[model samples]
Target chain A: MSLPKVRVPYLLLFPGFAFLFTFFILPIVNLAQTSTQTPIAGGDTGEYEQTFAFSNYIQAFVDNKEQFARSFVFATFSTLLALLIAYPLAYAIAFKSGKFKNILLVLVVAPFFTSFLLRTIAWKQILGEEGFVVPGLRSLHIISQQTTLTSTSFAVVAGMTYNFLPFMTLPLYASLERIDPRTIEAAGDLYANGITAFRRVTMPLSLPGVVAGTLLTFIPAAGDYVNAAILGSPTSKMVGNVIESRYFKIVDYPTAAALSFTLMATILVLVTLYIRKVGTEELV
Target chain B: MATERSLSPEARSILNSQISRRGVLAGAGGLGAAGLLAACGGSSSSGGEDTKTVRWGNWPLYLDFDSDTKKYPTLEKFMTETGLTAKYFEDYNDNDEFFGKVQAQLKLGEDIGYDVVTPTDWMAARWIRLGYTQKFDAANVPNKVNILDSLASPSYDPKRESSLTWQGIMAGFGWNTQKNPKGIRTLDDLFAPQNKGKIVVLTEMRDTLGIILLAQGVDITKVTENQFMNAVDFMAKKISDGWIRGVKGNEYAQDLTSGDATAVIGWSGDMFILASENEGKFDFAIPESGGTISGDNLMIPSTASADGKKNGEALINYYYDPMVAAEVAAYVNYVCPVKGAQAAMEKIAPELVNSEYIFPSDKTSSRLHIFRSLTPDEETKWAEAFQKAQGN
Candidate 1:
């Protein structure tokens, strides 16, 4: 039952390639087909035929440009926030945690034990009007009576940042942990100060992680609907929400597919430009 | 379950209802409620009349369930009597989502994992129109005659051939008693200054817009496009002006409980469950202008195997029994659609015999209006408009 030596690698790769073809590539192809479809004449609600209706993209984009803009804005904010929080924690765990590093890493991933939906819904309650945080802030004159946390864009962004923090932290931790301590000493030996040594030497070495972490955080954040659905009001709706409502609520499969393809294309282009600008050709 | 002599009827009823509420709340944390009754029965199907399993996909907390046993009492009884293994799943959160999940399979003539599905009235219409459901065998469902007169002739299934009414739902104003001391009876009251930015409305287009259309002095039963647009415009303005918080589904109950919403346009059964669970902290009222009434229909999808369909029909027939329907009505507190259920309730839960939510009187019934069925074109148009107003 053993495979020939030359064919062994191909045999080993068969399952992964088959999985990617079936679950990933097949759906993308189907989605692309659906994107170019037109509704059948005298047919049921969700029935469609492939007509290569490229105008579907134009129509979906024009109809949802505001959501498109809001999604990127929120994703950008959440990515920046996640980077600010995750970088320092990952740094501490990598360079300064001594023997407690593994425990810290486990703690970073501890929130994952619970379901993502549950965690997001928990945030909705924690920042809710009746939740202790809001009333406490109100009593301390930190927020006005009319001001609320839940159902606001701020809540949505906060939820996204929290949910995606581990995505940012783990990659950053791996890259930081891989940095040899001697590189920093070499910079210091060359008359670089602590801040200069860290910034010039450490930051460049971790560019791969920064590129990876930001991409991981931003791509999903841009397409997320649950945070907005649970913690945001109507004004904070994202493109993901539009696609969802179109597919389920309105049963507009053509429009939903068009939006999906558009979102995928937009994110791919943005990620390409981002990697090129950051000049990190190896990480992605 | 409460048999103490010192307890008043109201207290006993409250205790009984709380027991059910505990069950619902324990299992209900998110909109995606997936519950399997016992272990999933062995899937290998026997070829002929030996089918011993029935799988039903229904809304959460819709049946009479005992939390401690994690079993549906009526379903358990049905299994014992018919020697059938019943698998019930609380999988229907929204009509469109559930339909979207199985529509492709249904179109391909494949089993969508359930012998029976309970879709709301409008959705059932779509299923029947598309020939996606099988007509019930008249001999198998002999108790179908017990359907209430009002529900026996819905536009979707005039002859009761394909579907049976599961429960009638009335949508109106529900508010926190502490937040709205004066109560919310009309749209104006619902939009009062104190309730600004604290109001939640249903994602169901008919119920939310039906209430608004009624307040605008428009008959929801025959709403014109212009009338519907006006209601949609009004809702959009409220959402933009930060007077309404969210447009949500059954999860709106979370907002009500977490105090993110002070008032909502919600369903009667949910508000009743919330009120009982929270010590009467919540209340539901039919808007003075009237409220929307709809029903979820139980039907066997066409993809079901013949034996599966037969088992499904038997399950449907068992639910149509007045006593069994009354038992479910006592637990869920929705309007019972079985004609003799009220009389049967007098024996099972006497305190709920006259409960307006379960057995509305003439005055209560008069205030409830069924949102008329829509044309397919209008369905897409109106649903798009509704989602647009919600900023999706």
Candidate 2:
């Protein structure tokens, strides 16, 4: 509808906009301001000096570059690997399989019904030094004696992938399922083999799902302090863990707020650039 | 609304200098784009005005309520004497998380509606630094003489005159009999090859590292920057080497129960939970090298209403009554700041009365040391070095 005709709908949207305005937008602005406000060092009637310095950003990046780089690398690698494992399983149900497709879909989304913390913790218990997986592996002689999975990067990544597999697979399945099977059959009719048919008709069309699923799996995993806090060691701590330490462990509100806003701004820039290069609309 | 309206244009503008409405609206917009956060909760619970309330934020499972009874004796007597009602809260899960939530109201520079707030040692220091807490007059708390001469005048509060301590306890060593029949006797026991993968320590920056710092024979309380660096370096090395089991909450007890971890740096109050669960299987002890002794104190917020502060200041003194302290001691199993409360508890519940964990003998007292404040640069370097050492 034209703007003149749709004034009522716009009016209807005011409540939601007002709610978001009061709760969301106000906090970020306040966060940026609070981050810069320096508490009085020496006296009463002394107010915090409002200085807009960018050192908080420097601390998040240059000062703590190692953890920042590790977080980015983890996000990228986990997303790519999730896409690889997810694509084949989704393809089987969408392209070749006839029966049990809906049943398989239910199974994919089922784990989410339980507590995410519980599931992540279950993985920790299973992967601990004397836990289910390590003991079972030892009994079968699949690994050497005395090797434990607890407090390792492998355990962290494995837990991440397992927790987020449904996110990756469901989107890929939806994208693959929406494709016309006859297009592949049409390629075969023109004398293309199975590989050629899939490469030409299916792969190009499914890129959107691959991108979406990768994002759905990866972005949340980047901010996952819980996984590191429970399943991994200090070596496995992420940027989220650092943010938490500043916010809670130390009462450096200015530094904590500075780190929070800096992380947020960095994520925005990275996402904006990615969208620009990859065509944001296609990510759907 | 009252204060804002009372402000003249100049005063309002001054308040707005820090954060204007536009700034708040902009932040709300950004948060909307993020997602809805849970609403800010008020101070604990209150049954309402018919009862004068004291809003408390204490650790979970610390307060005692009988299975069939929710009786709190000190609270009852306080109500009887003062004709004021009691509304105790167990809302504080961790000290830092509570600070994060309360910071907003503090910034708004208004009544947080809490009559009393409690936090641990260094945290009390942070409140004093931030000016978020109120100052008290020593004259009001004449009953302060009831506090042990030894417990008075902590490093955090030089006169022991400002903040009222919630409970003071030693953050020492605890062991499981299931793993070490002979016990992990000293700080060196933590780094032993045999104990490599089977140890659990606390995540509190001061307690964990300070214990290790003391074990190295460095005085954690009186340390230079270089000495402090050595302590962090040592801790970071052990953490990165995977010699430590996990840093966590009170679940160190759970880790011991499941045999995932054998011994840990633990609080004495938590020993009550573990001893109940595993019976004589576990015990808490101070190592020979001496671990950090810490305490929690109740602080008055700067914004406490004048009327409330007047009464609350007196109420703080009132709790120091020997009978009141003894009843509180039975309910809360930490060090009785009140001098003679232990003997009173002995007359009440002889089992808990004799428990040495609640009242450490004088020998343990001589070795105990309270934590010292970190300089800003030192704090920065310490947090960074620790983080780097924990890196993959």
Candidate 3:
């Protein structure tokens, strides 16, 4: 069963290539096909045929523009919040935590042990009207009696940030840990202050992590329906919820597929522009 | 998705003793992933691989489950007596969601991993109309005669050929008793100012819209398209005005338990379970005008193997036995479809024998109305309108 020397790389790449072809590429092709379909003239619900109805994309977009915008807005807010919180946390673990770095890293990833849904639901309870947080704020007159946390856009964004924090932290830690402290010393030798040395040296070096962390956090958050479904009111729903309801509830497969393709294309364009703007060739 | 932290210690224990279907809403993704894994792993069990095996896909908490043993006692008994290995899956969350999951496979004429499935009245109609279901063999289910006369003939399954009624569901007002001591008996009560931003409604279009239509003096059984759209418009206005918190399924119980929802358009059975779990903190009332009544039917899919169909019929017949039906009715607290299940309840859980939820009296039954079956065109169009109203 010996492979020819020139054929070895192909042999080694076989499983990965096969998996991607079957799970990813094929589904995308099928989705593209489905996106252009039209329902049968007199068929039952969910019956569709290949009619090349590209207007489905436009219809889906026009109908769900609010949700699409909401998805991106929520994703952007969560990504920025996650970066702001995770960068400091990851910095402490990478540099200041010293011998306790591994333990601190474990603590950072501890939430993954529980199901994502469970954690999100837990957040719902913690922010719910009966939960201590809302009642406490009300009693202190910090919040009005009518003010609640759960089922609000704020809760949805908070949940997204919490759920995706680890995605931001680990990559930032890897990039930050790779930075040499001497780079900072060299900058300081050039008469730079603590903030300046870090910003000019360490921060620039961690751009790859920022790029990777932001992408990781943003992509999943943008597609997330759970956090919004559990914690947000109907008004806070995102595109993912629309797609889900379209596919399952309405049985409008073409519209759902069109929405999905549009989402993917939009994400692709945004990511391309983002990478181009950030100019991070060494993204994690 | 309500966690233990959302409940009092007492409620948590009660919720633990019974498998609250709403609690497993979190497992929806996990279940889908498991199905994918099974397909990829090539360990998937084909239907009717053996006549001694039968698999049923049903709604969560619809059967009698024992928390300590982590099993359905009636199911275990059926398996023991029939010498069959019966697998039960609470794979159904919503009619559309579950049907969508299996529809592609059904269209391909492939085994959908279950011999029997319980779809609601409308969904059952859809399945039959689509010819996706198999008619039962009368000889195999002699106990079919035990079905209630009222449920014996549905528009979809006249003469009860293709489907058998599993449980009757009543959709009405469910509210936190403490929050609305006066009770919510009318549509106006459900939309009161005090309950603003705290009301949830069922995603079941029939129930939610049917209640709204009834309140507006439209007869559900003869509801016109204009009448339905009026109700839809009313709901959309409420949602846009931020009066309604959510349009949900069984998980509305989660909202009620967590105090996120003060009132709901919820099922009678779920309200009963929530009331017991929370020490009567919750209560259900059939609206002064009326409430919507429907049934989930157990039917074998057409793609099921002959032996699987036979096994499925046996399973259905077993459940129809009044004694067996009584046991499940006691736990599920839904309206039992078995004709003599109420009399059977006298011997088992006599307290529930008089319970209106499990066995509604004539007066209570008179207040329940079945939503008219929609034409296929109306089904799609109306569902689209309903989803639009929910802001989906």
Candidate 4:
């Protein structure tokens, strides 16, 4: 039998393809081209000439390796912490909350209603030396007077986890809410306790959400500069801050673009490996 | 809408499957495109008509506003006299940030959407050096004669061909009176063991490093790379030792008020405002080694048409009138660059007539030093060192 030809489907793809080509693909191509440029000789502050200086990538990596390492380290910690916090909260909202589920979900996302920068600044205040957190801890002799919380790695990580928690929770909640209660009940009847049932049944089923949530949290967290800027000290500065300063302050676009491409490539490779390890069958 | 709700399940499923993904993706794409458009927006119109509307970009709280009238009185008066509408924008938050925003357009000789912009001295010098600014018609600004003699000839524009001073501020050490009862008299005092983790420095490279260089007995006016590197090393040591709390911009004032910072390297005008609000809670002191003085300057970008330039000059000329200058000085609490504004303040706001910070005493003036303009190469090197020390 001959298949029916359809012109509508191909036409339907045009808008999406055009949009991505103009906004995404074009910019990435431009950024890739910019990554190889070099500063013009005796030029003004921001002047540059395209020289195909692939060495920019090496120079950027060498100069900012510590920042790059710190970025991934912080992102990994924050992602793990967010998962640990989000899973339980998502589970409760999915199974425990009766009519208040929608409200709980809104509560999970209420922090986003405020500006991200403003929220980060609020965190700075809360963790400041003179703020309630430090003084209270000092009063209880839990921390020394000079041991501040504001400009530290811990604060930066905590801020990232807090800011990105919703990204982890919403996905987990969607997958968890769709779970069949009968399967878990059957597992219970088949000589399984609550923990065993969850591990054997629910956890494996929620792999898609876990994978999706972790990727969402990790990618943006790795590129986050505001949290580190507001809460972290120079010692805790991340790669994102370096890129920002290079582009805006130093006006060194080539190094900034090179670092950006490196970051994107690193994330792409890591994500591919992660998906493969997680198994493609669960993603659908 | 009612008919659409009555669709069959199979048909609705097919429709939803096909349209939902594209709909969501299209929505997101539209949002992204809107943001990109907004980011690149500026005046695209060329000047042929009488550009009666002048756009002025300035820092926040730099002009007096009548609470009762809910309008900038001086600006209103200027507009009525010139028959021109002035659109004032308080978007000049930081000099470098503003420069980064407009530099691309300025380089291409395109309008940055502002007829007048107020950038700090170093940035203005850079603009003049790059030929990105238009010269003011001296004939259009007769009130320019009232400009302070000391400010009439900056090294960057000795003839005052391109820029005019808006406000000058002293960069010095300020401390909370309640927090530091003994007082912070010098850079050494700020770095003393007792003040550890309570000190905050400015993020502006010139203000922070210039003060440090001055403290080290190096003249900031013509600092050498060795002197700059030494200052950077000293700053890095303080940062690594946790002696300095953080590097901040305008937020240093908030840090001071909240007691997060006991002492800060801050602008004199900000210190005055903070002190006045807190009532003896804060005090500003110029270090014995002298403090760095810098000014925000008004200049027309090269993109401005001849008509726009004239209107900008008219606005500048109006503000340069000693009475109008005094009005701005009384509200802004910065050093007025117009020479006769001090005497004019005697009638306008008598209380501020002798305010030393706004109109520096001869002794105070003698102790203030200007950080000399750096060559492009030196600027890049110094900025890189500063950024590294800043942990970027």
Please tell me which predicted candidate would have the highest TM-score against the true structure: 1
TM-score of 4: 0.91
**lDDT to native, each model:** 0.88, 0.68, 0.87, 0.83
Which stretches in model 3 have alpha-carbon errors above 4 Å? B1-44
Query: How large is the i-RMS for each model, in angstroms?
Result: 0.9, 4.7, 1.1, 1.4
Best prediction by DockQ: 1
Q: Please write out the lDDT profile of model 1 over residues B1-392, one tens digit for every residue.
A: 12211112343256445655445654543222243331343244322325787888888768876665656779889999999988777877789999998898889887777889999999999999999999999999999999988889988889999999999999999998798887788898899988999999999999999999999999888899989999999999999999999999888998999888899999988888777777767888888888889999999999888989999999999999999999989888788999899999889978787687888776778888988888878898899999999999
What order do you get sorting by DockQ, best first? Answer: 1, 3, 4, 2
- As for DockQ, the candidate ahead, 2 or 3, is 3
Per-residue lDDT tens digits for candidate 2, residues A1-284, read 45676688878899999999999999988888868766566522213467776665565566556666666666667777788888999999897778888888888889989999989878867776557788789899987775667667777777777878888999999899999888888999999998998888899889788877877887777766777777777777777777777666644556667766666676778777866777767666
Candidate 3's residue-wise lDDT over A88-149, tens digit each?
99999988997899999999999999999999989988998888999999999999999889
lDDT of 4 by residue, B1-392 (tens): 22211111222223322232223234334344334433543344444435687877887667775544445789989989989988777667787789989888888886787889998998898999899899989999888888888789999899888888999988888888776776666898788776688788998899999899999999988888999999999999999988887888888887787667889999887877666656567777777788889889999989888888899999999999999998888777788999888899889766567677778877778778999888888877788889889789
**B340, model 1: CA deviation in Å?**
1.5
Task: Supply candidate 4's per-residue lDDT for B22.
Answer: 23
Q: Once superposed on the true structure, which residue ranges of model 2 sit more than 4 Å away at CA?
A: A1-10, A19-24, A31-48, A88-107, A187-196, A253-283, B1-51, B67-83, B129-131, B134-143, B310-332, B374-392
What is the lDDT for A12 in model 4? 81
Q: lDDT tens digits, residues B1-392, model 2?
A: 22211111222122222222113234334333222211232522321322355444555544433332234445557768877655455566687788777776776776665666788887777677677877777787888777776767776677765687767777777777666666555877656766677677777767877787788788877877787678777766677677776777776766676557777888776664455444456766666677677777877777666655655676787778766676666655677777777787767655555455556656657677776776555555565565455552
Ordered by lDDT, highest first, the candidates read 1, 3, 4, 2
Local error of candidate 2 at A146, Å?
A: 2.7
Tens-digit per-residue lDDT, A69-154, candidate 4:
99999999999999999999999999999999999999999998999998888998888866898899999999997787877899
